[model samples]
Structures are given as structure tokens and as C-alpha cells.
Target: MIRPKLELADIFRAHGPAWRQANAGHVSLGQLKVMSAIEACRTETLGGHVAGCASCGHHHIAYNSCKNRHCPKCQGPAARDWMAARAEDLLPVEYFHVVVTLPAEIAQVAFWNKKAVYDLLFRASAETVMTIAADPRRMGAQVGMTSVLHTWGSALTHHPHIHMIVPGGGLSPDGTRWVPCRPGFFLHVRVLSRLFRRLFIEGLLALHRAGALSFFGDLAGLAEAGAFAAWLAPLRKSEWVVYAKPPFGGPEAVLAYLSRYTHRVAISNSRLVSADDATVAFRWKDYRIKRGDRQRIMRLATGEFIRRFLLHVLPDGFHRIRHYGLLASAGRKANIGKIRALLGQSPAIAPPEAGAEPVPLTLREPCPCCGGPMRVIEIFRRGQKPQSRAPPRDQAA
Candidate 1:
């Protein structure tokens, strides 16, 4: 993909210092680190290397990536790498895409209690699916799924939701048979929504009662038990949104979907139209529309754009992607083998032997001057420019 003319780095490099100073005490360490990482990515603030193509004597300087998960510029390669690793996990079965969303009232609370609340969101949603699938009336089998947490909508709003990819079937209770769901249907969305709402609310109440939740600003009154209960009163009756898309065409579609989502950031550079000293303009999709064009451009004050972007910097050490049931790290491989055998399929090839040196992944990025690899020749440290002179254009081999 071609790089965008504008980038998050451009905005950060221009406005981040001022924004940080203006919000000094209010900003978080994690957010500040994200800003710093993005601003310095592929710049002299980080070290770089010199790449040369011997075939044509083509040479150029290349900077390093921050590899920060929140960096929009970095997620492309991260997503590719993640998808490559997950490719082997796909099964020869239809996969369903399920979305579980937290309502607005609860989202406000999640703003202050990110780690605690999002943790509950992950567990409650996963448990709801696993529990429902395991019931004799539903599928009566153990299902496996991968759940990814997305905290931003197209307009960069803080909308926390889980996008789960689940196989349309599972291992039987006795672990002897593979049970598939009814064609074109996984589970009842209304039933999933109700159960998910109940489980999440129960978890939230436990957090509140155990004093694990904190209140601030307009929510300060919720510090008291009665006030907290009152705040949560209407949520119990309201309908939560949970929906499942029809099963994917096959494993190829599953891989394609995972590549787009697994390592996604709050926004991508392609969505950015332009930015100036005072304001920023970007494209967004208006999901409220059901049948018409949803493409729209939104302009926001420069400061507000940065604020919205920073709203999604997850808590340090908090995992945004998770696996559950058969996909859970523990026993995942073993479970897959069992399911394969039950399906009359052979077990997957063995992974590399213990302590064997793994093969390195070589990038096929070719230099523009000639169709050849750009081999790294010299390394430079941070805050330093390249000392070696570039090969003259006339010096082509």
C-alpha cells in the first residue's frame, strides 16, 4: 500500500508538545508515551540504518519503527505479522463474526475504570458465548473463539466493543465428535444480548460492591452504594446490542478478516484528508444510515482531534486481543488436534523442534530504482544522522 500524504505523526509533531503542556497534569504517562513514540517513529529521534542495492548501486536512509501498538503507522506490519501467525489456527469450518457492545451509560463508567471495566467486558462476553454454546439446548458443545477489543468508532469516539470470530461449531461434551451449528445461523442475537447484559451487569455490581470501581467528575456521586445502584438501575432493563454476522465463506475469508482487525489502531492514515494549524479534516462512516451513502468528512479543532485519538490509548500492560474456549492458550493445540481427528482430518504438522533456530522472515520490499532487495549496510544511533555519503546517481552498476 502507498503511504498516505498525511499521517498521525504529522499532526503529533506539529501539536503534541503544546497539547501536552496545556493538559500537563491531566495527561497520562501512557498517552504521553504514545504521543512520543508516534512523533519519533521513522524519524531521527529514533535510530536508522542505511540500505543499499548492490545490483544497481541504489541507496537510501531508512529509520526504525516504534512498534508501539497504538501507533497508526505501525499497525500495518503488526497486523500482517499477527495474521501470518494465526493462519495455521483456521479450521475447515464456517466462522461467525459476533459483536458485543457496551451501552453508552456503561461506557462513561468505562472511561475512568478502563482496565477493570474492559477486563470485565472481555470475560463476561467470552463466558456468555461459551456458556450458551455449551448448553444442551443451544449447541451442546465446547466452542472456541478469538475476541478482539476495539475502543474507537469511525469518528474516533470511545466506543468499547468486542469483535469475536468463532467457529460455527465445536467439540462435543465427550470430546469425541465435532458438532456444527444449524446452517447460516449461530445463535439468537436477542438471547445473547440479554445474557451478555446480565452477566456484564452482575460483574459490574461485584466490582462496585468490592470497591474495585472508582468514580470521578460527574460520576462522583456513584461512590455511595445507593447512588451506584441507582445509576445502574435502568441498565438492567435496557437492551444491550449483540449481533452476529453470517458465517464467512471459508477459512480464506477468516484470514482476510483477521488481517484487517487483529492489530488495528484507533485510526488509519488513509482516513486523514488534511490538517492545519487550527483544524483537522478526516473521512468517517455514519453507521446510523441503513441504506444510503455513509461516507462523510468531519472537521474538528486540532486539539480535539488529538484528544479523541488519545482517548483510545489502552492502559499499559492491558491486552486488547484475547482468545477463549478452544482458542485459549492453554490446551489450545491439543484441543485443535482432537477436533481435527474427530472431523476425520489428519493432525497439523509439528512445529519446529525445541531449541531449533527459527527461520527469519525476509521482507520483499524492493528498491524503486531497480527490482532488487534493499540490503541494510550501515547502522546509526538515535538523534544522529547518517555519516556515510550516498552513492552518486551516475554510479549505477
Candidate 2:
């Protein structure tokens, strides 16, 4: 694939220094590190390697990727590898897409207490599904789900939400059989919404009572228990958005959907239209519109653009992707084996032992010059130049 003329790296290199200076102490260490990593990615600063095609005289120099989870240019390969690793886990059943969003009031608090609140969001959303699905009136089964957290909207705004992919069916409560949903339905959004709101509110209040939340500026009044509870009372009256789309075809389709949601950063390089000293422009979807064209271009002052991008810098060591229910890491393989059996399929393969060596994933991208294999011939450290003088290749990014 040809590279986009504009990139987050280009924007960072051009304006990051000035923006960093202007914001000084306001930036968190996590955001600063992300900026530094993106600025140095794919350049000589991080070093690289030389790959040569033995069948032909072609050679190329490929720079090392920072492999930062938040890097726009880096997520492609990351997503591919993760998909590969998860390929074996897919079941031959339809999958439903569910989204649960935090209301604006709670989102504001989440911004300040990211780790605490985001953790609660994951637990609450997961429990809401497990609880609702286990009811005899509902599916009455132990379903599995994969949840991905997205903290930014299309315009790089702070809109925190969870995207979940669930199998259209689940194992019976007694683990005796498979239970499938109606062909065109999953769960009632209204029921899910009410339960999610209640669980999340209860969890948030627990955190607050445990002195886990922080408040500042206009929200300082929330430091008091009475004020905080009263503030949340209004949210109880309002409806939170919970949407569940019809089930996708099957596991492969679910994999395709996950490729987009799982490893995504706030914005990708392709979305960048242009960046200059004064302004940066990019494409964003206007979701508020229900008809006609929803695509729109948004331009922000360079400083503001950088600020908005940094707004999504997740806390260090925080996980953005998680599995729950039958997908829980502990007994995933065994659970899948049982579910597959109930579906009249062969038993799933077992994973390797604790200290077993992993099989390498081999994806051969033929040489651009000739349809021949390309193999790494040389490795170099950061700030060092490769011995062979081959032109840089897009294979690296």
C-alpha cells in the first residue's frame, strides 16, 4: 500500500515541540511518551533492518516500528497478528455487535479517574450481559463476549464507549447443550440500557465511597458525598444509549469486524488531509446526521488538534481489549471445546503447555521488484545505519 502523504507523525514532528512547550506541565507522562514514540517511529532514531531477496538482486531497508498500541501507522500489523493469534478461537455461529456508552456526565468524571472508572465500566458492562443473558426468560445460557473500549469519537472528542462482539448463542446453564437466539434478534436494548445504567451507577458510587474518585475545577463540589449522589440522581432519570445490531453472518465476518475495532487508535494516518503550522484537517463522520451524507471534514487549530489527540492517551498498563464469560482466559480452550461439541462440531485443539515455544507466523510478502521471497539479512540498532544502501520500503510500516 502506498503511504498517505500526510501522517500523525508528520503533524507531530511539525507542531509537537511548540505544542509541548505551550502545554508544559499539563501533559501527562503517558501522553508525552506516546508523542515521542510516534515522532520517532519508522525513522533512524529507532533503527531498522535490511531485507534481501535471494532469488533476485532486489533489496530494501525497513525501519523498525515503535509498536506502540496507540500509533496509527503501527496498528495495521498489530491487528493482523492479533487476528491471526485469535483465528483458532472463532466458533461457527453468528455474532452480534453491542455498544454501551457512558453518558456525558459520567464521561466527564471518567476523564479524571480513568483507571478506576474505565475498570468499572468494563466490569459493569460485562456483568450486565452475563446477568441478562443468564435469566431463564432471556437466552438462559452462559454466553461469551469480547469487549473493546474506544475513548474517542470520530472528531477526536472524548466519547468513551464499549464495543462488544457476542456469539449469537451460548452453552446451556447446565453446560449440557447449545442455545441460540432468534435469527433476527439478540437482546432488548431498553432492558440492557436500564441494567447497564444501574450497574454502572452502583459501581461508580462504590468507587466514590471507597475514596477512589477525584474531582477538580467545576466538579470540585462532587468531592462531597451528598453532592455526588445528588448529581448522579439526574442521570438516573435520563436514558443511556445501548445499541445492538443484528447478528453478522458468522465467525469470519466477526473477525473482519474485530479487525476494525480491536486495535484502532483515535485517528489513522489516512484520515489526515493536511497539516501545517496554523491548522490540521481530517475526515470525521457526523453521526448526529441520520440521512444523506454523513462524512465531513473538520479542521482545528494545530495546537487544539494536538490537544484533542492527547486527550485519548490511555493510562500506562491499562488494557483496552478484554474477554469475558466463556471467553475468559482461564478456561477458554476447554469452554470452546464444550461449546463446539454441543454444536455437533469436532473438539477444539488444545494450546501448548506453559513454557512451550510459540510457532512463528509466516506471512510472505513478495518482493516488489520480482515475485520472490524477502528475508531479513541484517539488523541494526537505534541511530545506526544499515550496511547495504538499499532504498527504504513500505514493508516496514
Candidate 3:
């Protein structure tokens, strides 16, 4: 019997008329490729290639995987490998998680200028951290931080935010000593929030001046410079929602966090409860409540679920994971070396893991009458195949 997970895959495998209707005018090349890849994943559509069984002499025609980054089936291994590479970059110090969110008013703008707005979110958040940490009145040191962009809320709604995992301390400007933040506090959330709003608005204005942002449909009126400026005016006056939780209890806690938050898409397969007929059910966390007790399960029509998931596909080739301050990619190694020397901490080295390839999967057995594991046994490949089998299975028996 197919498990629910496999059932979900089966659903993804079919390019249902419903999916076509929902995405009729909205499909992009990337989405089309993703759907096609999922449909052809284990089927013969793309033309199956052979993978001979070492033991059974079975010439199994293994179908090829699409290997697209956005495919849910393919992202797990990709995320694992990426996390492994980043494991070596962990600092042996306390770290904090900070979230910078755009108000709904700005989210409308962000929806249209995702790449540009997201980039600004990263830059603005990083700058806020670095500036405050380096202030003599504050931490008085230079900090290293990593940021990841998340574009969706728990219910797969369009909510743009930046999540940053930052070391809780930094090196002094003179590079003479390590400076630690107040035990329970990093930067002032209110101050950071204000600055973030300013920086983001400034970047938005720049993009508008550069003719890079678009306003369409409901946002058509925002195309006017005065309208946009007026729209941004209120956000600057109100709190911009910079949230900071306490530092991760330790370095290990930080790693556990990155594993959960970074590289995550709008939803994970495990969250899916079921997909039957034309409805899909899934679980999500309602973060508005206290942290540990906020999970909820919800259901949506299959078309709506797919639409929500695809809303976060991201602009092509956009980098969602970003490094800032000392962790910035340009000179991260050298900076890490400098910081390690100052803090008297050695460079991080990932512990060795028992490297092993996973066992390949195969069907339990061939249909009893067919004997042994199923195989193409013979190939009339594609158009060359005989019009029909000599006899159907029931008739053959």
C-alpha cells in the first residue's frame, strides 16, 4: 500500500487539470519545469534508463530525478549538504536569533520587488546589528552574523522577514580584546527596528528611482512617487517590528536552529497530513502565541495549497542565504582567522562522519507469474515498441 507521503508524491506526479486551471496564466518556466520533473520522476515519460541489479540480474529502468532546487523531493539532500558545509563555519560562542519583518504595508511593495526588497532586508538588518554592536555605548565591538530570508508565514501567506543568527559578541575596534554583549541583551529592538525601517525605505526609494520596481493590480496606484512616499511615511513613524529572542543556550543550540530555519521552503513534506480528491491538509505553527505551544493543522483545496507553495518559489537565481559582517563571503576566511586569534579560539573543524551511500531501493518482488524482480527484459524502446503485449496478464494465466 502506498504511504501518505508516497500518495503526496503521486499527486505531485500528476499535472491535474485543476493545477493547469489554477496556474493557467501565472506559470513560469521554473514552475513548469518543476511540475514536469515531479510528474516524470518515477515514470517512463522522460524515457527510463537502466540500472542493473547487482544480485538479481534485473535490468531495472530507473527513471531520472529532475534535481531542481525547488522540488520538495530534491531539497532535503541539498539542504543537508549545504548545512554540512556551513557546519565548519560555526563559532565557539553564544549566538542570538533576530528577526526583522516588514509591515503588511511594505509587504505589498515587497511582493512586487521581491529580489530588491529582500536584498535590502538583509543589508539593513546587518547594518543595524553591526552599527549598534560597534557603538561604545553598546557592545562596542564588531560582530559576525549570518542571515536567511523567509518569504512566507506559517500558513504559507506572503510575509517577508529576515532571520539572522549572530554571534553574541564581537572583537573590539582595535582588535585587542573580545567584547561580549549584555548577558541577556544584544541590540535594543526598538532602536534596531527604527533604523531597519529607514534603511529599507531608503533602498526602496532607490529602486523606484532606478525604475526597477513594478506596481500592478491592487498596487497600481503605488506607482506614483507621491503615493509611495506617503505610504512609507507612516511605517517610519510606527515601530518596524525588529524582534530579538535570547541567545541560543549555546553553540549547539545555534546549530540546531540553523538546521530548522535555514534552507526551509514555504512548507515541508512532513507537514503535509493528507491529499485526497482535491484537498490537501497540513500542519503549521501559529507563531503569534508562546513558542512551544503554537502548532496548528489546516486544510486547503489542492489548488490553493499549490498556489501558496509556488508563491515563494523566489526569483530565479536569488541567493536566500546570506552572510554579513565577519561572515560575509568576500573575506570570511581571513576574518574568521582574525577573530579566532583575538578570541583565542581555534578555527572550527567538522567532526568526521561515517561516510556511506544509502542503500538503493527496489520493489519487493515481481508479480508472481512474471517471476523474479520486474525488468524491461526486452526493449522495443519508445516508438519501436510492439503495439501491444502478446496477451494481457489475466489471459496469459
Question: What clash pairs does model 1 have?
Answer: none
- Candidate 2 residue-wise lDDT, 283-348, digit = tens: 999999999999899999999999999899999999999999999999888898888887888765
Top candidate by TM-score = 2
lDDT leader? 2
Poorest 10 consecutive residues of model 2 by lDDT? 357-366
Q: How much is the lDDT of residue 4 in candidate 3?
A: 35
lDDT (10s digit) by residue, model 1, range 1-397: 3457899999999988898888999989999999999998977678877777758867766678899999987888889878877877778888999999999989999999999999999999999999999989999999989999999999999999999999999988988889999999998889899899999999999999899999999999999999998988998999899999989999999999988898888888889999998999999999999988999999999999999999999999999999999999998888888888888877767766666743332134667677776677778898777876764222322
- Predicted candidate 3 versus true structure: per-residue lDDT over 250-317, tens digit per residue: 76677778877776777776788878767888988887887577878898988887777777877878
Clashes by residue pair, model 2: none
Reference-based lDDT, residue 222, model 3: 77
Worst 10 residues of 1 by lDDT: 357-366
TM-score of 2: 0.96
Better of 2 and 3 by lDDT: 2
Off by over 4 Å in 2: 348-363, 395-397
Scored by lDDT, model 3 comes in at: 0.73
